[model samples]
Target chain A: MEDIWKGLMHAGALLFGGDPGVWEIIGLSLRVSGLAVVLATAVGVPLGYVLGSRKFRGRTFIQVIVNTGMGLPPVVAGLIVYMFLSRSGPIAAFATDVLNWWDPAAAPHDAPRLLFTVGAMLVAQVIISCPLVIGVTAAAVGSVPLEMRLQARSLGATSWHEALLTITEARRGVMAAIVAGFGGIISEVGAVMLVGGNIEHSTRVMTTAIVLETQKGNFDVALALGIILIGMAFVINNGLTALQQSGSRYER
Target chain B: MSADARAGKSEPIIVAENLTVRYRKRTVLDVERFELYEGETHAVLGPSGSGKSTLLRVLGLLEKPATGRIWIDGAQAGSADREARLMMAAVFQNPYLFKGTVAENVAYGLKLRGVSAREREDRVDAALARVGLEGTQRHSALQLSGGEAQRVALARALVLEPRILLLDEPLSYLDPLIKRKLVADFSEILTTSGVSAIYVTHDQDEAMVVADRVSIMHEGRFVRSGTVDDVMGLPTDPWVADFIGMETALDGEIVDTEEGIARIMVGGQIIYACSMFCPGQKVLVGIRPEDVMLFAAQSEVPVSSARNRLTMRVEAIEPRGALVRVALRRDGLRLASSISRASLRDLDLEPGDDVTVLFKATAVHVAAAQGVPSRL
Candidate 1:
C-alpha cells in the first residue's frame, strides 16, 4: 500500500516532466486512443446517420445487432485479431518478410509488422468501441424532430441533401458519441493485450501495461497506470455527457 | 404557365377527378370532382373533422389520394414526381417555422433548388417584402408572432414560385382586424402575381369573402361546389343553404298551394310562401336572416311577392358589429334576421314592440331533406 502511494506520487511528479519515458507513454496512450476514436467516428457516424434516417426491411435487426455489439468483450476482439496475424494464422505469412522500414539495425532479426503493433492495438480497440459509437450516434440523429424533416422536404431537399443536413447539424452529438467510445475502449483490457502483445518498447498501451505490471507483482506502477486510466475514463465520460446534453438543448 | 400549359390553355390548373382518400380501415375523404383554376382563390370550407385539412393535404401532394388522378397545369401529376413537387407548395394553418433566422427559413427552398447564393438572398428579401415582412430578414424565426409566422409561411411558399399555393386555414387564429388585413393583402398579391391558391378554412365568412369558387365539405364529401355567389345565394342543398347563413328555418304545412301562389299556416297566422309544394304537405322553409326586413308601425306589405310576410313583435335586438340580429315572433313562429344597425335604428326596434316582417318569396327557399332537424 505504501509503495503504491509512493509510486502514485512519483507518477504525479513524472507527469510534470521528470522522466522522458513517462511522457512517451502518455503521448503513445493519447496517440493510440485518438487515432482509434477518429477512425471509428469517420466510419461510424455516417453509418449511424443512415441507420437512423433510412427505412428498410430488417432495420430493427441491424439495430439489434449494433446494440448487442456495443457490449462486446474487448479481449475477445484482441483474440480474433491475434489469430488473424499469428504465425499459424491466415495472414501471418505476409508479416514473415516484414520490410525493414523503421530500423535497419534490427532488420536481420524478426521484422516488426503492423500485426502485434500499435496500429493493430488501435484497430482492436476501435472494433470493441465502434458499436457503442454507432448506437449513440444513431440515437442522436433519430432524435431530430419530424417537423424539421417535413420542413426540409417541403423546402425541396432530396434524400442526399437531407442526410447531409442531418449530419452537419448533428456534428456535436456525433463527437460526443466518439468521445464516449474512446472512454469505452481506453479502459478495455482484452483486445489490446491480444493484438498489441504488450511488448515493453514497441507496443505497450496503458491498459496492457497496467495488466502486465500487476501480473508481475509490480503493484506501484500498476496502481499508478490504473489511476491514470480511471481518471481519463472519468473525464471522457463526463465531457461526453455534457456535450450530449447541450446538443439536446440546441436540437429542441 | 409553361409551354405545356399554354398549349392546353383551356385546361384547369388543378383537377382532382373522383378523389378519395382512405386510411387503414376508414374512408377519410371522397370528392367527386374538384377543380381549381389559374389565378383564382378556391376555399375548402368545413368545420373541424369535416375533412377540410385532408382535402388540402391531398391537393398539396403531402398526402396521396387512395384513388384519384391529380392534374396540374395540364400535366398528369401522379406520373411526374419532380413536377408535382415543384408545382405546388402548402402553408399549414400553424406555420411551423424552422429554428433559424427568417431569411434562412425563407431561402431554404430556393437553396435546395440550387439557386445562386446572391439570387437566393435577393429572392428571400423580395419575398419577405411581398409578405409585408420587409426588413425582418435577420430576425429570429422563433421570436415571430402567430400572424407573423403565418406571413412567413406565405413568404416561404411564395419564394418557391410554385404555380399553385395551398394554405390550410392560413389565417385561422388571427384577430379579426389582422384576419381582414391578411385576407386583403393575400388576395391583392395573389391577383397581381397570378398565382392560383387553394385556401382551406372552417370560417364560411372567410370562404365567402375570398373564394372565387367555394366547396362546402361535410363528412369528407363536398355537399356543394360552385362560384361563391352561386353556392351562398342559391344553394341547391338544404345543408348548404343553412351553412350559408340562412338562419330562419321554419317547418309548416302548405295550404292553398296552387300555381303562382302558396299559403303556409303555422300555429295561428297564415303565411304565404313562393314555392311549388302542394297544399297539405310539409316543406322546409329557409330564408337568410338578412333577407327578412323588420319594420315598425305595421304596414300591409305586398301580399304575395315573397309569399311569407307576417306581423311579428320584436323580441330582441342584439347589436352586432355593423349589423343587428333582430329576433322576432309572430303567431308562434320565432325567427332571427340580420339587419343593418342603421335599419334597426331607423325602425327604432325594441323588445316586445310589434313589427311587421316582410319575407320576399324570392328570398325564401323550400326543400325536402330526410331527418331534417326541427330546430335547424
Candidate 2:
C-alpha cells in the first residue's frame, strides 16, 4: 500500500516535472499503438465488412481463422515479425535478391534492417491488434439487420451504396471495435520488447521502459510508468466508451 | 374517353416476362408475364409463403430472377441497373429506419439521387404531411411507434416520387386501428399522386380496398387475376371460390337444363344454377353467404325471382361483426346465410329453428369440380 502511494506520487511528478525521458517513452507508446490501430483499421474494416456481409465458399473457414487469430498470443506475433525483419529473413532476402536485381545501385539493398526499430514495433503491434479489429468489426457488421440493406437498395442505393448505409448503421459497433483494437495494443509489452529491443532514445515505449527500470532496481520509476500506462488506457477507453454509450439507444 | 379505353391506351410502367425464382431445388415463383399499367394499382394477394413478395421483389429489381427479363418504361433493365432501380421505391413489412432524425431518414433516397438540399427539404415536408406526420422532422426515427415508423417509411418512399412504388405488406405490422387509417391515407395518397404501385399482401380486404386490379396467387402461381369484383364475385375454381370467402360450396351433378339455367342435384335436393355445364357433368356450386336471404319458415313464402328455395334447420347462429351467420342444414346439404343483426332480431331465429333460404340461380357459381365435398 505504501509503495502504491509512493508510486502515484512519483508518477505525478514525472508527468508534470518536465521529464523528457518519461515523456518520450509515453509519446513513443502512443505513436506506435496509434499508428498500428490506424493501419489495422484501414485494412480490417473493409475485410471485416466483406467477411460479415458476403456469402461465398470458404467463408466459414476464413471466419474461423480470423476468430482464432483474435485470441492469438502477442509474443508469437512479435516472434513472427522479428523473423521477417531479421537480416537473413525471407523479406530481407527478397528485397536484396529480387527488388535490387535490376537496380544494384539502390540504397540499402536489404529491407533496411528494421529489426530493432520503431517500424518493427509497429508491425508487431499491428499483427497483435488487427485480428481484434477485424473480429469485432465483423461481429458488429453482421449484427446489422439484412432488412437495412434491402431497404436501402430498394430506395435507389447501388450495391456499394447499400453497403455504405449498412456500415453507417453499424458505426457505433465499429467504433467500439476500433477502441478495442487500440486497447489491445496500447499497453502491450511483450511484442514491442521482442521487436523493438527496448533501445534507449530510439524504441523505448512506456511498457518496455517499465520492464527495464524494474529489472535495474528502479522500482519507483517502473511503478510510475505502470501508473501512467494504466491512466492512459483508462482515459482513452473511457472516452471512447462514453461515445459508444451516447449512441447506444439507437443501436438496436 | 372511357376509363377502360384510357387504361388500354396507357403503356404498362413495368413488365416482367418469364420470371422464375428458385431456391435450392424448389421453384418459388414461375410467373410467365405480369404487367403494371401506368397510374394503376395492381395488388398481388396471397396467403403466406405464396411467393407474392418474391414477385414484387423481382418487379422492383431488388432480386434478380433466375430467368426473366424486366422491362421498365419499355426498356429492358437488369436487376443491378441503378438507373432502373431509381425509377421505383419500396416499403417493406418493417420500416427499417436508420439511426437518425425523421428528416434524415426521409431524405436518404433524395440525397442518394443528389437532389438539391432545398428541394429535398421541401419534398420531405410534403411527403411527411401526406402521411399525416407533419412537424415530425426533427424527432428521432428510432423513437417512433410501429405505426409512426411505418408512416415515416412511407414518406421516405413518397419523397422520392418514384415512377413505381412497391409495397410488401407494409401495413401488416401495425395495429388494426392504425392499419385502417393508414390504409385510407395510403389509398388517397396513391390516388392523388397517381403513382403506379404493386402492393403485395395476404389480406383480401386490403386488396379489395386499395387495388384497381388483383391477382390471387397460390403456390407461386396466379390462379386468378382480374378486376376485384370479377375475381371475388365469380370464382371459377373451387379453391378460388373457397379462398374468396364463399360460405357454402356444394358438390353436385348437373341433371337438367332449360334456357340459360341448369338444375343440379345437391344431396337429393334439386337446385337451379345459371351455368354452362351440360347434363351428367360433376360441378361444384358456390354461394356467398350474403347472397342468401333467410325467412321464417312459418311465414307465407313471398314471390321472388329466386329460383331456389328450401327449408333448412338452423345448426348454429354465429355472430360476425354486425351480421349473423345462420348455418343451416337439411339432410346432407349444409349452407350458410349472412343476415343483418336487425333481421335476426325481427325473425327471432335461434339454433334448431327452421328457416327458408332463398338464392337466385345466377348467384350460384358452377365450377367443374369432380370430387370436392360440400364445405359449409
Candidate 3:
C-alpha cells in the first residue's frame, strides 16, 4: 500500500509536470489509434449499412463472417498484419517496390521497412477494430424501421437520399459503433506491441511504455501511464455517451 | 392538342392494368384493372390482410407488382422512377417521423427537392396550419401525441404538394374522438386541396364519410366498386352486403312476382321485395338493420304501410353506441335489428319474448344467388 501510494504520487507528478517522453508516448498512442478508428469507421459504416439493408445471395454468409471477425483475437490480427507486411509476404512488395517508386526518399535503398513502424501498428489496430465497427453499425442500420425507408422513398427521396436519411436516423448507433471501435483499439496492447515492435522513443505507445517501464522496475511511471490511458478513454467515452443520450431523445 | 396533353387531361391520374403482387408464391394482390381519376378520393375498404394496403403500395410506387403496367399522370412509370414517385406522397397507419422538430420533418421533402431554407420554412408553416397544427412547427415530432404526430405526418406530405396522396389507414391508430375530429379535418383538406388520393381503411363508416368512390376488396380482389352510395346501398354480392354492415342477408326463394314486386318465402314466411324476379328463383334478400322496426307481440297491430311482419323470439340484445342490436331468431333464421336503446326499453322485451319485426317492402334488396353458397 505504501509503495502504491508513492507510485501514485510519482505518476501524478509525471502527468502534471509535462514529461515530454510520457506525453510523446501518449500522443503517439492517440495518433495511431485515432487514425485507425477513423479509417475503419469511414470504410466500415457504409459497408455495414449496405450489408444490413440489402438482400442478396451470400448476405447471411457475409454477416456470419463479420460476426466471427468481431470476436477475432487481437494477437491473431497482429500476426496476420505482421506476416503481410514482412519481407517474404505478398503485400511486402508494395512497401518494397511500389512505395519506393511512389516516394524514394521515404523508402531509401529501395527497402520500405514497415514492420516496426507506426503505419504497421495502425494497420494492426484497424484490423482489430474494423470488425467491431462493422458489426455494431450493421446492427444499428438494421434497427432503423423499414417504414422509414419507404416513407422517404414515397417523399421523392432517391436511393442515395433514402440511404442518407436512414443513416441520419441511425446516427446514435453509428456513433456508438465508432466509439466502440476507438475504445477497442485505444486500450489494446497485444496488437500494437506485436506489430509496432515497441521501439524506444519511436514506436512505444502508452500501453507498450507501461509494459516496458514495469519490466524495468519503473513502477511509478508505469502506474502514471496506466492512469493517463484510463483517463483518456473515460474522457472520450463520456463525450460519446453524452452524444448518444442526446440522440436518444429523438428516438420515439 | 398533342397526344400527351390530351392524355394528361382526359386519362385518369393513375391506371393499373393486370397488376398482380405475389409474396412467397402466394398472391397478395390481383387487381385486373383499376383507375383513379384526378382530384378524387378513392377508398379501398377491406379487412386486415385483404390486400387493400398492398394495392395502395403498388399504386403509391412503393411496391412493384409482379406483372403490371402503371400509368402515373398519363406516363408509364418504371419501378424506380424518381419522377413518377415525386408525383405522389403517402401517409402510413403509424406516423413515422424522423428525428427532428415538426417543422424539419415537414420540410424534409422540400429540402430533398433543393428548396431554399426560407421557402421551406414558409411552406412548412403553411402546411402545419393546413393540418390545424400551426404552432407545433418547433415541437419535437417524436414527442407528439398520436393525433398530433399523424397531423405532422400529413403536414409533411402536404408541403410537397404532390399530384396524388396515398393514405393507408392513417386515422386507424387514433382514439374515437380524435379520429372524428381528424376525419372532419381530412374531409375539408381533401376537398380544398383537390389532390387525387387513394385512401385505404377497414371501416365502412370511414369509407362512406371520406370517399367519393369506394372499392370493397376481399381476398386480393375487388368485390364491388362504385360511388359511395352505390356500393353501400346496392352491394351486388352478399359478401359485400355483409362486409359493409349496412344490411342483414337472408336466403329466400321467390314464390310469386306481380306488378314489379317479388314475393319471397323465407323460413315459412312470405316477405315482400320491391324488385322484379322470376318465380322459383333462389335469391339473397338484404334488409338494413335500421329498417327493421320491432314491437311487442301483444301490442295491437300498428296501422301503417309496412308490408312485411314476422314474429321473432328475442335471443340477445347488445348495446352498440347510441343504439341497441337486438338479435331475433325465428325458426333458426336469425336477424339483427338495430334500434334506439330507449325504444328497446319501451318495448320491455327480454330473452325468449316474442316480438314482431316489421319492415317496408322496398327495404328488402334482392340479388340473384348465383355465387352465394347455400350455407352463407
Candidate 4:
C-alpha cells in the first residue's frame, strides 16, 4: 500500500514534472503501437470487407485461419519475428546471398540487420494485432444487412459506391476493430521486449521499461509506468468509445 | 419499327428474352418473353412463392438470369453493367433506408450521379412533395414510421428519374388503410409522371387499380397476361378463374348452343352461358360474385336481359369492407354473391331467407374442364 501511494506521486511527477527519460519511453511506445495499428488497419479493412461481402471458394477456409490467428499468442509472434530477422536467419541469409548475385563486387557483409530495432518491434506488434483487426472487421461488416447493399445498387450506385456505403454503415464496428487492434498491441510486452531488446534511449518502451524497473527492485518507478500505461489505454479507449456512440444518433 | 410503334403507339422500353434463373436444382423464374412499354405500368400479380419478386429483380438488373438477354432502350445489359442499372430504380418490400436524414436518403442516388448540392436539394424536395412527404428533409430516416419510411424510399428512387421503376410489393408491410392510401397515391404518381414501371404484388385488387396491363404468374411462368378486364372477366383456365376472384366454379356439360348462348346442365339445373362451346362439351362455368344480384323471393321477377335466375336460401352473410358477401345454397349447389351493404339492408335478408339470384349470360365464363376438378 505504501509503495502504491508512492508510485501514484511518482506517476504525477513523471507525467507533469518534465521527466525526459519516462517521456521518451512513452513516446516510443506510442509510435511503435500507433504505426503498427495504422498498418494493420490499412490491410485488414479491405481484406475483411472482401471476406465479408463476397462468397467464393476457399473463403471459409481463409476465415477459419483468421479466426485462429486472432487467438495467437504475442510471445509466439515475437519468437517467429525473431527467427526471421536474426543475423543467421532466412531473411538475412537471403538478402546477403541473393543480392550478392546482383552486385558481385559489393561487400558481402552489408546485409541490413533488423533484429533489436524499432522496425522489428513494429513487425512483431503488427503480427500480434492484425488478425484481431481482420476478424473483428469481418464480423462487423458481415452483420450489415444484405438488403442495404441491394438498395444501394437499386439507387444506381456503382460497385465502388456500394462498398463505400456499406463501410459507412459499419463505421461503428470498424472503429471498434481499430480500438481492439490498438489495445492488443499497446498492452503487449512480450513481443516488443523480445524483438526490441528494450535498450535505453533507443528501443525502450513503457511496458519493457516497467519490466526492467520492477526487475531491478524499483517498485515505485515500475508502478508509475504501469499507471501511465493504463491511463493511456483508458484515454484512447474512451475517445474511441465516444466516437462509436456518436454514430448511434444515425441509427434507430 | 414494330407494328405498335409504327401505328403511333408507345414503344417497348425494356424487353427480356428467355430469362431463366435457377437456384441449385430448382428453377425459380422462367420468363420466356416480356415487354414493358414506355410510360406504362405493368403489374405482375401472383400468390406467395410464385417467383414474382425474382422476376422483378431480374428485370431491374439487380440479378442476372442464367440464360437470357435484357435490352433496355435497345442496349443490352446485365447486373454487372453500371450504366444500365443507373437507367432504372427499384423500391423493395421493406423501406431499407440508409443511415441518415430524409434528405440524405433521398439525395443518395443524385449524389452518386455527381449532381451538384443545390440541384440535389431541389430534386429531393420535389420528390418528397410528390410522395406527399413535404418539409421532412432534416428528419432522421430511422425515426420514421413504416409508411413514412416507405415514402422516403419511393422519393429516393423517384428523385433519380429513372427510365423505369421496379416496385417489389413496396406497400406490403403497411397497414390496410395506409396501403390503400399509398396505392391510390402511387397510381396517381405513375399516371402523372408517366414513368414506366413494373409493380410486383400478390394483391389482385391493387393490380386492377394500378396496372395498365397485368401478367398472372404461377409456378415460375405467366399463365395469363392481358388487360385486367380481359383476364378478370374471361379467365381461360380454372386456375386463372380461381385466382381472379371468380369463386363460384360449377362443372357442367353444355347441352345446347345457339347464337353464342349455351345452356349447360349443373346440379340438375340448366345454366345459360355466353360461350362458343358445342353441344355435349364438358365445361366449367365461372361466376364472379359481383355479377350476381339478389331480390326478395316474394318480389316480382324483374324483367331484364339477364337469362339466369334461381331461388336460393341464404346460408351465411359476411361483411367484406364496403361490401357484403352472401353465401347461397339450393339443392346442394353453392354460390356466393357480393352486394352493397345498402342492398343487404334494404332486403332485410337473414340466414334463412330465400332470395332470387339473377346474373347475365355474359357473366357466365365457360372454360374447358378437362383435368381440373370442380372447387364447388
Candidate 5:
C-alpha cells in the first residue's frame, strides 16, 4: 500500500513537473487522436447525411454495415493493420526492416514496433469509433420533419442551404453524436494498446498508459490515468446533456 | 379594389391542366383539370385526406407531379424552376415557422427573393400590420396561438407579394371567431391587393360565402366546378345534392290554385309549396330547412309574399341555438321546417300544437337532382 502511494506521487510529479518527454508523449497522443477524428468526421458525416436524407438502393444494407462496425473489436483492426503495414509483408517495403512481417499465420507481435508509433494508434482509434459517429448522426438528422424540408425548399432554399439549416436545427443530436464519438476513441483499450505497443514516452495515451502501468504493477499510476479517463467521460456526458436540453425547446 | 372588376369577373389567371400525381405507383391526385380565375377566391372543397393537400402541394411546386401541367401568370411553368417557385406562395395547414422571431418568419420569403436587410425588415413590419398583428417583431413564432400562427404564415407568404397565394386549409386550427376574423382579414387583403388566391376548405357555407367559384373535389377528381350558386342550386350529381343538404324529394303535380301561386301535393297531403310551375304540369319540389318557416295555431305575422302558409300540428321541435327545427304533420304528411328561437318564443310553440307554416315561392328551389323523376 505504501509502495502504491509512493508510486502515485512519483507519477504525478513526472506528469506535471519533472520530465518534458512525458508532456511530449501527451502532445503526440492529442495530435494523433485529433487528426484521426477529423479525417473520420470528414468522410463519415457526409455519408451519414446522405444516408439519412436521400433514398436509394441498398441503404438498409449499408446501414447494417455501419451498425455492425459500431461493435467491431478493436484488436481485430490492430491485427489487420499489423499484417498490412508490416515489413516483408504485402506493404512491408514501406516499413522498417526491424518488423518481422512476412507470415500472416504468426501472432500480432511478428509484425513489428510499427505499433510503437502514434500513427498506428490513431488508425486503430478511428477504425474503432467512426461507425458510432455515423450511426448517431444519421439518426439525429433523420428526425428533422419532412414538412420543414419541403417548406424550406418551396421557399427557394437550395439543397445545400437546406442541409445547413437542418444541422442548425438538430444541433443537440449532432452534439450528442460528437460527444459519443469522442468518448469512444478516448476510452478505447484493445486497439490502442495492441497497435500503440504501450511504449512509456512514445505511443502511450492515457488509455495505453493505464494498461502499461498495470502490467508493470504500478497500481497508482494506472489508477490515476483511469480516474482521469472516467472523469473525461463524465464531463463529455454532462456537456452533451446540457446542450440537448438547451435545444429541446424547438422539438414539438 | 375596383367594383367594376368584381362585378365583371374575367377569365382565370392560373390554370392546372390534367394534373395527375403518383406516389409509388398509386394515384395520389388526378385532377384531370381545374382553373382559378382572376379577382375571385376559388376554393377546393373536400373532406380530409381527399387529395386536396396533394393538389395544393403540386400547384405550389413543392412536389413534382407525375404527369400534368400548370400555367401561372400567363407563363408556361414546365421549363422554368426559378420563375415558378417565385410565382406562388403557400401557407400549410400547420404553419411551418422557423425557430426565430415573428419578424424573421415574415422576412424569410423576402430574403430568399434577394431583398436587402433594410427593405426586408420594412416589408415584414408592413405585412405583420396587414395581418392585424402589429408590433410583434421580436415575438417568438412558436409562442403564437393558432390564429396568430396562421397570420404569421400569411405574413411570411404575403411579404413577397407573389402573383398567386395558395392556402391549404389555413383556418382549420382556428376557433370560429378567429376564423371569421381571419376570413375578414383575407377579404380585406383580397380587396385591397390584387393578388389572386386558391383556398382549400371543408366548410360548405364558408366556401359559399367567401369564394366566387367553389369546386368540389372527390375520389381523385373534381365532380362539380362552377359558381357557388350554380353548384348549390343545380348540382350535377346525386352525391352533390346529398352533400349540399338536399334532404327530401317528393313527387307532385303543379296546380295553379291561387292567382299567382302554385301548390305541390306529395303523398296526398297539400304541401302548398310556392312555385311558378305551369298549371297542370308535373314538377319536382326541393326545399331546404332554413327556407321553410313554421308558425303554431295562428300566424300573427302579416301574410305577405309568403305564398305557402298552412296550419299544421308540431310533432317535434329541435332547438339548435340560433335556429330551431320544427317538424310538423299536416293532413297525414310529415313536413319539417326551420324557424328561429325568437319566432318560436313569439309563437309560444310546443309539440302537438297546430301551426301555420309559411314559405316563399322563389325561395323554394326546383331540381331534378336524384333518381326521383324529372317531373313530380
Candidate 6:
C-alpha cells in the first residue's frame, strides 16, 4: 500500500514535471498506436462496409475469418509480422529492394533489418488492431437497417451517396470501432515488446518500459508508467465517449 | 389555362406495360398495362400479399421487374436512371426517418440534390407547414409519436417536390384515431398539391375516400380498374365482389330473363337480378350488406316494392359500430344484412330468429361462371 502511494506520487510528478525520458516514451507509444489505428481504420472501415452491406457468395466464410481474426492473440500476430519481415521472408526482400533505391546508404547491406524496429512494432500493432476495427465497424454498418439505404436511394442518393449517409448514421459505432482499435493496440505489450525489441530512446514505449522497469525491481517507475498508460487510455476514451454520446442523443 | 388544365395537357406521368415481377418461382406482380395520368391519385387496392405493394415498388422504380418497359414523363426509364428515380418519392408503411432533427430529416433530400441552404430551409419549412407540423422543425425525429413520425416522413418526401409520390400503406401503422385524422389531412394535401400519386393499400374505405380512380388487384393481376364508383359498385368478377365486402354471393343458374331482369335459380329459390344474362347461363349473384334490409317476419312485408323478399333464419348477429351485422341462412343460401342497431333492437332480432330479408333486384350484381369459382 505504501509503495503504491509513493508510486502514484512519482507518477504524477513525472507527468507534470516535464520529464524528458518519460515524455519520450509516452510520445513513442502514442505515435506507434496512433499510426497503426489510423491505417487500420483506413483499410478496415471500407472493407467492413462492403462486407456488411453486400451479399455475395463466400461472405459468411469471410465473416467467419474476420470474426476469428478479431480475437487473434497478440503474440501470434507479433510472431507472424516478425517472420514476414525477417531476412529470409518474402516481404523483407521486396522492402529491401525498394529501400535500396530510395536510400542506398541507409539500407542494410547483408540482410533485411526491419526486425526490432519501430516500423516492425507498427506493423504488428496494425495487424493486432485491424481485425477488431473491421469486426466492430461491420457490425455497426450492418445494424443500420436496409430500409434507410433504400429511403436514401429513393431520395436520389447514388450508391456512393447512400454509403456516405449510412456511415454518417452509424457514426457512433464507427467511432467506437476506432477507439477500440486504439485501445487494443495501446494496451498491447506482447506484440510491441517482441517486435520493438524495447530499445531505449529508439523503440521503447510506456508499456514496454513498465515491463523492463518491473523486471529490474524499479517498482516505483514501473507503477508510474502503468499509471501514465491508464491515464492516456482514459483521456482518449473519454473524448471518444463524449463524441459517441452526443451522436446518440437523436438515435432511435 | 389553370394549372390543372395545363397538367391535363401534359403527357401521362407514368406508363408501364408487360410489367412482371417474380420472387423465386412465384410471380408477385404481373400487370399487363397500367397508366397514371398527371394530377391524379390512383389507388391500387388489394388484400395483403395481393401484389399491390410489389406493383407500387416497381412503379416507384425502387424494384426492377422481371420484364417491363416504363416510361416516365415520356422518357424510357431503365433501372439505373437516376433522373427518372429522382422524379418520384415513396413513403413506406413504417415511418423510416433517419436519425436527426425533424428539420434535418426533411432537408436531407434537398441537401442531396445540392439545393442552396436558404432554399432547403424554405422548402423544409413549407413542407412541414403543409403536413400540419409547422413548429416541429427542431424536434428530434426519434422522439415523435407514430403519427408525428409519419408526418415527418411525408414532409421529407414533399420537400423534394417530386413529380409523383408513391405511398405503400402509409396509414396502416397508425392508430385508428390518428389514421382518421391523417386521412383527412392527406386528402387535403393531395388535392392542394395536385401531385400525381399511386396510393397502395388494403383498406377499401381508404381507397374509396382518397382515390379518384381505384384498381382492384388479385392474384398478381388487376381484376378491375375504373372510377371508384365503377369499380366498387360494379365489380366484374366474383372475387372482386367478395373482396369489396359484398355480403352475399350465390351460385345460380339463369332460369328466365325479360327486359334486362334475369330470374335466377339459387338453392331452389327464384331471385330476380337487374342484369342481362342469357337463360340457362351459370352466374354468381352478389348483394352488398348495406343493400339488404331486414324486417320482422310476422310484420307486413314493406309497402314499397322490393323484388326479392325471403324468410331467413338468423344464424349469427354481431355488433359492428353503430350497426348490427345479421348473418342469415335459408336452405344453405347465406346472406348478411347490416342494419342500424335501433332497427335491430326494434325488431328484437337475435341469433336463431326468423327474419325477412329484402333487397331490390338492381342490388344483385351478376358475373359469369368461369371467374366466379375462384372466389368460392
Among these predicted structures, which one has the highest DockQ?
A: 4
Candidate 5 Cα outliers beyond 4 Å, as residue runs:
A1-15, A18-22, A77-120, A199-202, A234-252, B1-11, B23-26, B78-80, B248-289, B297-376
- Computed on alpha carbons, the lDDT of every model, listed in order, comes to 0.75, 0.87, 0.86, 0.88, 0.73, 0.87
Between prediction 3 and prediction 5, which has the larger TM-score?
3
- Kindly report the interface RMSD of candidate 3, rounded to 1 decimal: 1.3
**Candidate 4: stretches off by over 4 Å:** B1-8, B248-287, B295-308, B312-336, B339-355, B360-376
Cα error of candidate 5 at position A122, Å: 3.9
DockQ of every model listed? 0.24, 0.63, 0.70, 0.76, 0.35, 0.69
Cα lDDT tens digits for candidate 3, A1-252:
766787789878888998888888989999999999999998899988998788789999999999998999898899999898887777777656776777778655444576999999999998888888999999999999888898999998988998899888898889988998998899888889998999988899999999988999988888888988888988999998897788666556
Candidate scoring better on lDDT of 2 and 5: 2
| Model 6 regions more than 4 Å off | A96-112, B1-12, B17-33, B217-226, B234-242, B247-286, B300-324, B327-335, B340-354, B358-376
Clashing pairs in 4: none
Interface RMSD of 6: 1.3
| lDDT for residue A48 in candidate 5, whole number 0-100 | 74
Candidate 5: clashing pairs of residues: B12-B37, B252-B376, B296-B355, B297-B354, B297-B355
Query: What local lDDT does model 1 show for residue B121?
Result: 92
DockQ-based ranking, best first? 4, 3, 6, 2, 5, 1
Q: How many residue pairs of model 6 clash at the backbone?
A: 0
| Ranking of models by TM-score | 4, 2, 3, 6, 5, 1
Per-residue lDDT over B1-376 for candidate 6, one digit per residue giving the tens place of the 0 to 100 score: 3334544676678999999999989998899999888888889999999999889878877778999999999999987899999999888898789888999999988998999999998999999998989999888999999999999988888889988999889999998999999988888888789899899999988988788788999989999886675577655566886677554357789898888888998877888888677787888666778888998999987586789999999998877777777888889567778889899889998798899989999887777666544221
- The DockQ of predicted model 3 stands at 0.70
Number of the candidate with higher TM-score, 4 or 6: 4
- Cα deviation at B28, candidate 2, in Å, is 2.4
For B323-354, candidate 4 gives per-residue lDDT tens digits of: 98898888755667889999999999999999
Per-residue lDDT of candidate 6, residues A1-252 (tens digit): 988998999998998998999999999999999999999999999988888888889999999999888899999999998888888898878877787888888766556688889999999999988889998889999999987887888888888998898888888888988998898899999988888899999999988999999999988999999998888888999999998888778866
Judged by lDDT against the true structure, how good is candidate 6? 0.87
* lDDT tens readout by residue for model 1, B221-311: 9988766654565555657655555543566677776664677766566766566766667665555678887667655555455556577
